[model samples]
Target: MVYVKRALPPRKDNGQRGRVFIRRAPLNRKLRPKQLLSRFTVLWVNTAGVPFSTAGFTCRASSTGGTLLATANFDNFGTAIFNTIPTPTARTLVIRTFDADDNLFRTRTVRSGISAFAIIG
Candidate 1:
Protein backbone atom coordinates (compact mmCIF):
# COMPACT_ATOMS: atom_id res chain seq x y z
CA MET A 1 0.00 0.00 0.00
CA VAL A 2 1.11 3.56 -0.66
CA TYR A 3 -0.11 6.98 0.28
CA VAL A 4 -0.02 9.92 -2.09
CA LYS A 5 -0.50 13.53 -1.10
CA ARG A 6 -1.85 16.06 -3.57
CA ALA A 7 -2.83 19.67 -3.27
CA LEU A 8 -6.52 20.24 -2.70
CA PRO A 9 -8.45 22.26 -5.21
CA PRO A 10 -9.79 25.62 -4.21
CA ARG A 11 -13.43 25.61 -3.12
CA LYS A 12 -15.68 27.41 -0.71
CA ASP A 13 -15.15 25.43 2.44
CA ASN A 14 -15.33 26.11 6.12
CA GLY A 15 -11.89 24.53 6.65
CA GLN A 16 -8.53 25.64 5.38
CA ARG A 17 -7.36 24.43 1.97
CA GLY A 18 -4.45 22.00 2.17
CA ARG A 19 -3.34 18.69 0.78
CA VAL A 20 -5.35 15.53 0.28
CA PHE A 21 -4.13 12.06 1.12
CA ILE A 22 -4.95 9.08 -1.09
CA ARG A 23 -4.15 5.47 -0.30
CA ARG A 24 -3.50 2.82 -2.92
CA ALA A 25 -2.73 -0.85 -2.57
CA PRO A 26 -0.28 -2.65 -4.80
CA LEU A 27 -1.75 -5.14 -7.26
CA ASN A 28 0.75 -7.76 -6.17
CA ARG A 29 3.21 -8.25 -3.36
CA LYS A 30 6.71 -7.24 -4.36
CA LEU A 31 9.09 -10.15 -4.82
CA ARG A 32 12.28 -8.21 -4.16
CA PRO A 33 13.56 -4.95 -2.86
CA LYS A 34 13.70 -2.08 -5.35
CA GLN A 35 17.49 -2.33 -5.56
CA LEU A 36 17.27 -5.97 -6.65
CA LEU A 37 14.46 -5.58 -9.19
CA SER A 38 15.50 -5.48 -12.85
CA ARG A 39 13.34 -4.21 -15.70
CA PHE A 40 12.61 -6.23 -18.85
CA THR A 41 11.03 -4.88 -22.00
CA VAL A 42 8.94 -6.96 -24.39
CA LEU A 43 7.11 -6.06 -27.57
CA TRP A 44 3.89 -7.82 -28.53
CA VAL A 45 2.60 -7.32 -32.03
CA ASN A 46 0.46 -8.71 -34.86
CA THR A 47 1.96 -11.08 -37.41
CA ALA A 48 3.40 -9.79 -40.67
CA GLY A 49 0.20 -10.57 -42.61
CA VAL A 50 -2.15 -9.81 -39.74
CA PRO A 51 -3.57 -6.30 -39.33
CA PHE A 52 -3.84 -5.80 -35.58
CA SER A 53 -2.49 -3.71 -32.75
CA THR A 54 -1.13 -4.50 -29.30
CA ALA A 55 -3.24 -1.94 -27.51
CA GLY A 56 -4.83 -2.74 -24.14
CA PHE A 57 -2.37 -5.56 -23.51
CA THR A 58 -0.81 -6.52 -20.20
CA CYS A 59 1.54 -9.28 -19.10
CA ARG A 60 3.03 -11.02 -16.11
CA ALA A 61 6.20 -12.98 -15.60
CA SER A 62 6.77 -16.12 -13.59
CA SER A 63 9.69 -18.31 -12.67
CA THR A 64 10.00 -21.80 -14.08
CA GLY A 65 9.12 -22.78 -10.50
CA GLY A 66 5.70 -21.08 -11.02
CA THR A 67 6.32 -18.03 -8.86
CA LEU A 68 4.85 -14.86 -10.30
CA LEU A 69 7.51 -12.19 -10.74
CA ALA A 70 5.61 -9.07 -11.77
CA THR A 71 2.86 -7.62 -13.99
CA ALA A 72 2.78 -4.62 -16.29
CA ASN A 73 0.70 -3.03 -19.05
CA PHE A 74 1.74 -2.16 -22.56
CA ASP A 75 2.48 1.44 -23.40
CA ASN A 76 1.63 3.29 -26.59
CA PHE A 77 4.71 1.75 -28.19
CA GLY A 78 3.50 -1.81 -27.42
CA THR A 79 6.21 -2.47 -24.86
CA ALA A 80 5.41 -4.41 -21.74
CA ILE A 81 7.61 -3.28 -18.87
CA PHE A 82 8.45 -5.97 -16.35
CA ASN A 83 10.33 -5.81 -13.07
CA THR A 84 11.62 -8.96 -11.48
CA ILE A 85 14.26 -10.37 -9.15
CA PRO A 86 17.15 -11.25 -11.42
CA THR A 87 19.79 -13.92 -11.12
CA PRO A 88 23.51 -13.43 -11.73
CA THR A 89 23.29 -15.86 -14.62
CA ALA A 90 20.58 -16.00 -17.27
CA ARG A 91 17.35 -17.64 -16.21
CA THR A 92 14.27 -18.85 -18.06
CA LEU A 93 10.89 -17.31 -17.30
CA VAL A 94 7.31 -17.92 -18.35
CA ILE A 95 5.67 -14.74 -19.53
CA ARG A 96 1.93 -14.55 -20.11
CA THR A 97 -0.10 -11.81 -21.74
CA PHE A 98 -3.68 -10.78 -21.14
CA ASP A 99 -6.22 -8.60 -22.87
CA ALA A 100 -7.86 -5.55 -21.34
CA ASP A 101 -10.54 -7.77 -19.83
CA ASP A 102 -7.80 -9.82 -18.12
CA ASN A 103 -8.26 -12.73 -20.48
CA LEU A 104 -5.10 -14.72 -21.05
CA PHE A 105 -4.01 -14.36 -24.65
CA ARG A 106 -0.42 -15.44 -25.10
CA THR A 107 2.53 -16.99 -23.31
CA ARG A 108 6.21 -17.25 -24.11
CA THR A 109 9.48 -18.40 -22.63
CA VAL A 110 12.04 -15.68 -22.10
CA ARG A 111 15.73 -15.83 -21.15
CA SER A 112 16.38 -13.02 -18.74
CA GLY A 113 19.49 -10.85 -18.51
CA ILE A 114 20.47 -7.92 -16.30
CA SER A 115 19.13 -5.21 -18.62
CA ALA A 116 16.02 -4.57 -20.72
CA PHE A 117 14.96 -7.17 -23.30
CA ALA A 118 12.96 -7.04 -26.52
CA ILE A 119 11.00 -10.11 -27.60
CA ILE A 120 7.92 -10.50 -29.78
CA GLY A 121 5.05 -12.44 -28.23
Candidate 2:
Protein backbone atom coordinates (compact mmCIF):
# COMPACT_ATOMS: atom_id res chain seq x y z
CA MET A 1 0.00 0.00 0.00
CA VAL A 2 1.14 3.60 -0.62
CA TYR A 3 0.19 7.11 0.47
CA VAL A 4 0.73 10.44 -1.28
CA LYS A 5 0.17 14.08 -0.34
CA ARG A 6 -0.34 16.42 -3.28
CA ALA A 7 0.59 20.11 -3.26
CA LEU A 8 -2.64 21.63 -4.47
CA PRO A 9 -3.57 25.28 -4.36
CA PRO A 10 -5.75 26.39 -1.47
CA ARG A 11 -9.45 26.32 -2.24
CA LYS A 12 -11.16 29.63 -3.02
CA ASP A 13 -14.65 28.69 -1.85
CA ASN A 14 -15.50 29.73 1.68
CA GLY A 15 -17.38 26.50 2.34
CA GLN A 16 -14.35 24.46 1.31
CA ARG A 17 -11.64 26.48 2.97
CA GLY A 18 -10.06 23.48 4.70
CA ARG A 19 -10.95 20.78 2.21
CA VAL A 20 -8.45 17.96 1.66
CA PHE A 21 -8.22 16.17 -1.63
CA ILE A 22 -7.03 12.59 -2.00
CA ARG A 23 -6.64 10.26 -4.95
CA ARG A 24 -6.19 6.54 -4.36
CA ALA A 25 -4.90 4.18 -7.02
CA PRO A 26 -3.65 0.64 -7.11
CA LEU A 27 0.13 0.28 -6.94
CA ASN A 28 0.42 -2.64 -9.32
CA ARG A 29 -1.14 -5.95 -10.24
CA LYS A 30 1.13 -7.86 -7.87
CA LEU A 31 1.21 -5.47 -4.92
CA ARG A 32 -2.48 -4.62 -5.12
CA PRO A 33 -4.27 -7.44 -6.80
CA LYS A 34 -7.49 -6.63 -8.61
CA GLN A 35 -9.42 -9.09 -6.44
CA LEU A 36 -8.26 -7.44 -3.24
CA LEU A 37 -8.78 -3.95 -4.62
CA SER A 38 -12.39 -4.70 -5.33
CA ARG A 39 -12.98 -5.59 -1.69
CA PHE A 40 -11.38 -2.49 -0.26
CA THR A 41 -13.33 0.04 1.78
CA VAL A 42 -12.38 3.62 2.64
CA LEU A 43 -12.78 5.71 5.80
CA TRP A 44 -11.65 9.23 6.68
CA VAL A 45 -11.42 11.70 9.56
CA ASN A 46 -10.43 15.25 10.46
CA THR A 47 -7.25 15.39 12.55
CA ALA A 48 -7.16 19.14 12.95
CA GLY A 49 -8.75 21.05 15.82
CA VAL A 50 -12.01 21.52 13.94
CA PRO A 51 -14.71 18.85 13.95
CA PHE A 52 -16.79 17.67 11.00
CA SER A 53 -20.45 18.52 10.96
CA THR A 54 -23.07 15.90 11.67
CA ALA A 55 -24.44 16.21 8.14
CA GLY A 56 -21.82 13.67 7.02
CA PHE A 57 -19.44 13.69 3.98
CA THR A 58 -19.31 12.69 0.35
CA CYS A 59 -17.04 10.48 -1.76
CA ARG A 60 -16.84 9.72 -5.47
CA ALA A 61 -15.28 6.56 -6.85
CA SER A 62 -14.38 5.39 -10.32
CA SER A 63 -15.71 2.05 -11.44
CA THR A 64 -12.82 1.10 -13.71
CA GLY A 65 -9.68 2.60 -12.13
CA GLY A 66 -10.44 1.71 -8.52
CA THR A 67 -9.74 5.32 -7.56
CA LEU A 68 -11.72 7.51 -5.18
CA LEU A 69 -12.15 11.12 -4.05
CA ALA A 70 -13.24 11.77 -0.44
CA THR A 71 -14.11 15.17 0.96
CA ALA A 72 -14.70 16.17 4.57
CA ASN A 73 -17.20 18.76 5.67
CA PHE A 74 -16.18 21.65 7.87
CA ASP A 75 -19.63 22.86 8.87
CA ASN A 76 -22.31 20.51 7.64
CA PHE A 77 -24.80 20.84 10.39
CA GLY A 78 -28.44 21.45 9.54
CA THR A 79 -29.27 23.27 12.73
CA ALA A 80 -29.78 27.01 12.72
CA ILE A 81 -26.98 27.69 15.19
CA PHE A 82 -24.37 25.85 13.16
CA ASN A 83 -25.69 27.16 9.89
CA THR A 84 -25.05 30.74 10.88
CA ILE A 85 -21.73 30.18 12.66
CA PRO A 86 -19.35 27.85 10.90
CA THR A 87 -15.89 26.77 11.97
CA PRO A 88 -13.33 26.92 9.21
CA THR A 89 -9.71 26.05 9.89
CA ALA A 90 -6.68 24.13 8.75
CA ARG A 91 -7.96 20.58 8.97
CA THR A 92 -6.17 17.31 8.31
CA LEU A 93 -7.33 14.69 5.83
CA VAL A 94 -6.85 11.19 7.19
CA ILE A 95 -7.77 8.41 4.78
CA ARG A 96 -7.76 4.71 5.57
CA THR A 97 -8.60 1.65 3.51
CA PHE A 98 -9.29 -1.84 4.73
CA ASP A 99 -9.18 -5.16 2.98
CA ALA A 100 -11.80 -7.91 3.06
CA ASP A 101 -10.39 -9.26 6.30
CA ASP A 102 -10.92 -5.85 7.90
CA ASN A 103 -7.15 -5.42 8.14
CA LEU A 104 -5.92 -1.92 7.54
CA PHE A 105 -4.17 -1.86 4.19
CA ARG A 106 -3.25 1.82 3.91
CA THR A 107 -3.45 5.02 5.93
CA ARG A 108 -2.49 8.61 5.07
CA THR A 109 -2.88 12.15 6.39
CA VAL A 110 -2.74 15.46 4.53
CA ARG A 111 -2.46 18.68 6.50
CA SER A 112 -1.76 21.43 4.01
CA GLY A 113 -4.17 23.36 1.79
CA ILE A 114 -7.21 21.91 3.51
CA SER A 115 -10.43 23.31 4.91
CA ALA A 116 -13.49 22.20 6.86
CA PHE A 117 -16.70 22.79 4.91
CA ALA A 118 -19.98 21.07 4.38
CA ILE A 119 -20.64 19.03 1.30
CA ILE A 120 -23.99 20.73 0.80
CA GLY A 121 -22.69 24.19 1.51
Clashes of each: 0, 7
Query: Candidate 2 lDDT (Cα, whole model)?
Result: 0.35
- Candidate models: Cα lDDT each: 0.69, 0.35
RMSD of each candidate? Answer: 13.7, 22.5
Cα lDDT over the full model 1: 0.69
Query: Candidate 2: where are CA atoms >4 Å away?
Result: 1-90, 114-121
Candidate 2 residue lDDT tens string, 1-121? 7989889997677676678889866676355322322122222335543333434333322223244434323224321121221233223434443433445534454343333222121
- Candidate 1 residues lying further than 4 Å off, grouped into runs, are 1-38, 49-52, 84-90, 114-121
How would you encode candidate 1's per-residue C-alpha lDDT over 1-121 as one tens digit per residue? Answer: 9999999988778675696878866879565544343556667655553323667878888889999878888876677766554443267878888889999887788775544444543
Q: Give the number of the best model, judged by lDDT.
A: 1
**Model 2 poorest ten-residue lDDT run:** 78-87
TM-score of 1: 0.53
RMSD of 1: 13.7
